[model samples]
Target: MGGRDVATASIWDAAHRRTTVGLLTLVTLVAFEAMAVGTAMPRAVAELDGVAWYAWTFSAFLVTSVVGMVVGGEVGDRRPPGPGVLAGVVVFAAGLVVAGLAQHMAVLVLGRAVQGLGAGVVIVLLYVVAGQAYDSRLRPSLFGAFAAGWVLPALLGPLAAGLLTTHVGWRAVFLGLVPLVAAGLVLLLTGAPGGTPPADAAPWRSRAGWALLAGAGIAALQYAAQRLDLAAAGIAVLGAAALAAGLRRLLPRGTVRARRGIPAVVASRGLLAGAFFGMDALLPFVLTEQHGWSAATAGLPLTAGAVGWVVAAQLQGRRPDVPRQRVLRLGALVLTVGVAATATVAVPALGGWPAYLTWGLAGVGMGLGMPSVGVLLLDQSPEAERGANSAALQISDATASAICVGLSGVLVAGAADAGGPLWPAVLAAVAVLTVPALLTARVAGRTVAPAADPSCATNLGR
Candidate 1:
């Protein structure tokens, strides 16, 4: 019999089954770790006496991930994806061990930084693998599967982490995941296909210097945000300069300006991530510090949001005929509304309990937008440049998230120093940050590239 048409084939079909299962397993593990950390962080920082440095834990991971993203993209373009993924899993497991054993906030931060490095590599390589292994028509289903992987973790990770942190100590949250990573490694090794690099892969040149510079710039900016002195101004300026210099080399030309096509797609990812995650990183803190909720209680709203996200993502996947730009625009508008409503929780009289509902709305927005961006990106990218473009997308997210989270941290730190509530200040910072989402919505039209499968050489400058 003639071979079945790949376009209409299910991701679970025999030819694709192992890789799909392995990819979903890995994604679920990553999502579980992310949810667990968010739920456990408040207690973890309190015991380590790092409440004032709270944002650093997040920023440190994001900054170092930028470096890893650049390197991973380069490696994926030049070699087989399997070995790079294996290396990343090993490093990630080591970081988990270090974090679980931490006796101080500094050590925990160090461990988080290492985890970021490995995660960045693993995620980017996975995208390259997806691009290589599946037909374009099958990608929406694959991305949907990836989002579904987050669903179980979103539902249970918070509750599990909270129970562990309360009953067994927060250390269990990190250490417990090591075995899962090992299992994912086994699946990946068995399933990942061997393939030759693209014949037109760009010549390898070292991007490490630029990546490190960008990472350092973000770290310096985060540190400066925590200070309330004149030197902070100087440091912020220097950091901005260094970050600009570094990003110019790493991202597509005109990405900073939201130029048309792939650049616009990359820009949208940054804006959406910055607005959502910036607030997400601070939400648990807002509840515990401002509302006096228990760690477990604070995590519930996050779980609600994840539910909304997964639902919307699955919906989007089922209807691949919808224009991605339209979905992107709608998601941004919805998120803007959700953020505005959630801000009311900061007002002392509002009771703050409605965040459970409002934040889920925000999650729905992200669900619609994020996967749309991913699908659009791959559809636009030529085979040889898929790895690099994927890196650019991730770097945009990490850089913007670090900046947004850092800025919010500054406001919260200032409020705490003055013996005031943190929620009001965070409310204001989040309101201002929503501007980017609004801009993204307005420019969503530009994310479509002019050519069918435009390569980096022809597409970026437009």
Candidate 2:
């Protein structure tokens, strides 16, 4: 159907209402979990006495999620997406149980790994659902709904998590969501249409093996970063080699090199994620440790950032005529400024108050740029390659974020050992990490093909 013809139909119309609600519920819950974790993690780490392994909590989840994404993509292609999505829900809920009941940092990390697996499967399968069940015209709207799913979570998740952690303990943050997941699962089973499975199953063994290797590599790197011994060197080398090998198979050809078109889009996504989330995961820690703020108070800045992200994304959505590449570049620029400004919080005299505003600016950058990458990825990918590419986009995002977080963790540990000002080290790390955002801005133009339609790029993958 033409765009104008389909404009009259709403995603909330009778045909799509049930499935839409179900999908949005799942998306919101997942978003809430992600947002809540950052707020709860600082307290959780301190209580477990696993302060040394703080980065591992995030890295493990991100690294393990690569395995889940690969599996979800393979399953979605070969069989019914419902079963895989259901399995994801079960696994995710189980992880929450494990994390909530944890006694030590190791157990918490393990639970996080489990959560990663479920999150990966659920996320990829959700994309599959959108593609198979919804009309092409309705997909833009569906994706818009997906963006909307993050709104409430962004607004309230950090604050809610902080309050829970301060009053009820961090375990409550994890356990509290179990019932909501069950509700979302019921919604999906009842409302979502099950499309016909592929006639023949494609072999996924090779991809799965690579994903495992990559996950292992990421975990090893995170572990090694915390250790000061010589053995850490060998481990780091081995991990890098494995990560490189795995990425070669998992990503589109030349993605690491940032070859133009889809490859550049994929690469840009990784760089943007690495630069943004690498710091985001640490902001709460920065606030609590350096500023002497309560967990709830520390989370308010994150809330500000989320609000900015949503607002900028809404503005981007309204201006369909704006070229995506331009928006992507502009977002990168704004994000770069935000990251730089945010680093000043590490300075004792500046105070943490500025971060709330600066991080919000960074969020606006992400809002404008991140969604643009998703739209471009879909526009550029062939239909047959869409599922795989979608998985690649996710893998890229997670991999980069894990690496950045681990690097930050190392700096954090160093600052503790030095016993000087922690903010100075944080500032240096932010300076180094902000390079990726600058790089992303430089390559943003290559994300679009020379002859592509900018209007069509406004649809899908968000």
Candidate 3:
């Protein structure tokens, strides 16, 4: 299961057309749900008046999803991943239906929690499918395409969600998913038959322990967010204990510190994702509270970012033969520029378009770097532990983003509650984001080297 067992490759795999299609469909569903919720949640919360627990809805899903990822990774390594994926999709669709019919905030939260579980399973399962089905040569392109699949949601999520929420009611947002999820399920099941033999052995990842860790960690995080109380200390302690038990036994050594090639890629992704999305989670509040914009208007910059992501992804796909490390470095440099540009909005002489520009560039940066990072990990990740490695990747993102965004929320909430200047609060959020973006850029410059194919897996000895 160690990364040493995996081999690297170059070029694209032409034979996996059906498998690739299946993977793409899964990615599309993920994008759809993400964007759809971004649009509809505001209305859902307003109607339910569950603003008090706003962050929990997301936090709950994220925390459980992390565990699901870990568990899925282990399961994926040892058996047929298709059944797990099918179960996940069904649960997710059921959650959506329940959410659409929710009559109370509590019920809605419960549905969201179920949805979170399904999402986590599906997310890791997609990685498993990619790892198991695609040759090393073709993975980068696939990852790039995966990132591209999200573009539709980015382009239309907010606008569509707004319309649905405003006119059709947010309930329609959840209900609308029925057709898409159903279609994706059918496609995944029928699009590709068994392409590979099942694993000959069982993976060692413990399901019960992983569930405990994810549940405890996220529950603690959410509880901490609800009230900065002394009890947070106890909950945090419990979460830490659970996470350690689950992850310490599973992930590669030095993963938290990015010690070597694979760990470095995974660690860098976690930090990078945390910083970017943390900033993202805050930028909207700044627009709405400080600049006096509408929810729809606040979403425009994000939509622009989505556009940038799509463009970059498509370009990357077209040039699948490009050097990977170079591409990664360039992507990192773009991220630095994008993040730095956020501060431009603070400049008095500039108009609000500065912020929009920043997000757009950041999106492009993400499309280039995110897939590259994932592909690089896949390069080094041992085949048997595909789910484990993928879980590590997502947990890194979830853990980091959750903490960063949660911290920003606390800072912003505290400031607003104290009647502090809104711009200053926004700046505080922006400042934290800049740190990781710059650091990641430095890492990319120091670490990445040109490769024959940006999409394949390779391990340069650290």
lDDT of each: 0.83, 0.83, 0.72
Cα displacement (angstroms), candidate 3, residue 321, comes to: 3.0
Off by over 4 Å in 3: 1-17, 41-56, 166-169, 193-203, 226-250, 423-425, 445-462
Count of backbone collisions in candidate 3? 3
Prediction RMSDs, each to the true structure:
4.3, 4.6, 5.2
| TM agreement with the true structure for every prediction | 0.86, 0.83, 0.84
Better of 1 and 3 by lDDT: 1
Evaluate residue 323 in candidate 1 and report its C-alpha lDDT on the 0 to 100 scale. 74
Which digits, one per residue and each the tens of the lDDT, describe model 2 over residues 1-462?
Answer: 567646666668876788888898888998899889988999999899998878878878877789888888777777777888999999999999999999999999999999999998888888777776665445544655676687678787877998999999999999999999999888877778876676655565548789989988988887788685699889989998999899999898989888888889989999999998888878888988998889778878877787887778767765555677888999999999998888877977777999889999998988888877876776676544556777888889878987898888788878878788897788878997799999999999889876575554555424
Question: Which candidate, 2 or 3, would have the higher TM-score against the true structure?
Answer: 3
lDDT of 3 by residue, 121-162 (tens): 888888877776666656777887888776776676767788
Model 2 CA deviation exceeding 4 Å by range: 35-60, 97-113, 133-141, 158-176, 189-193, 197-206, 284-296, 346-348, 419-424, 450-462
Q: What is the lDDT of residue 368 in candidate 3?
A: 84
Each prediction's total of clashing residue pairs, residues at least 3 apart in sequence or on different chains, is: 0, 0, 3
Cand. 1 TM to true fold: 0.86
Candidate 1's residue-wise lDDT over 149-175, tens digit each?
A: 867787888789989999999999999
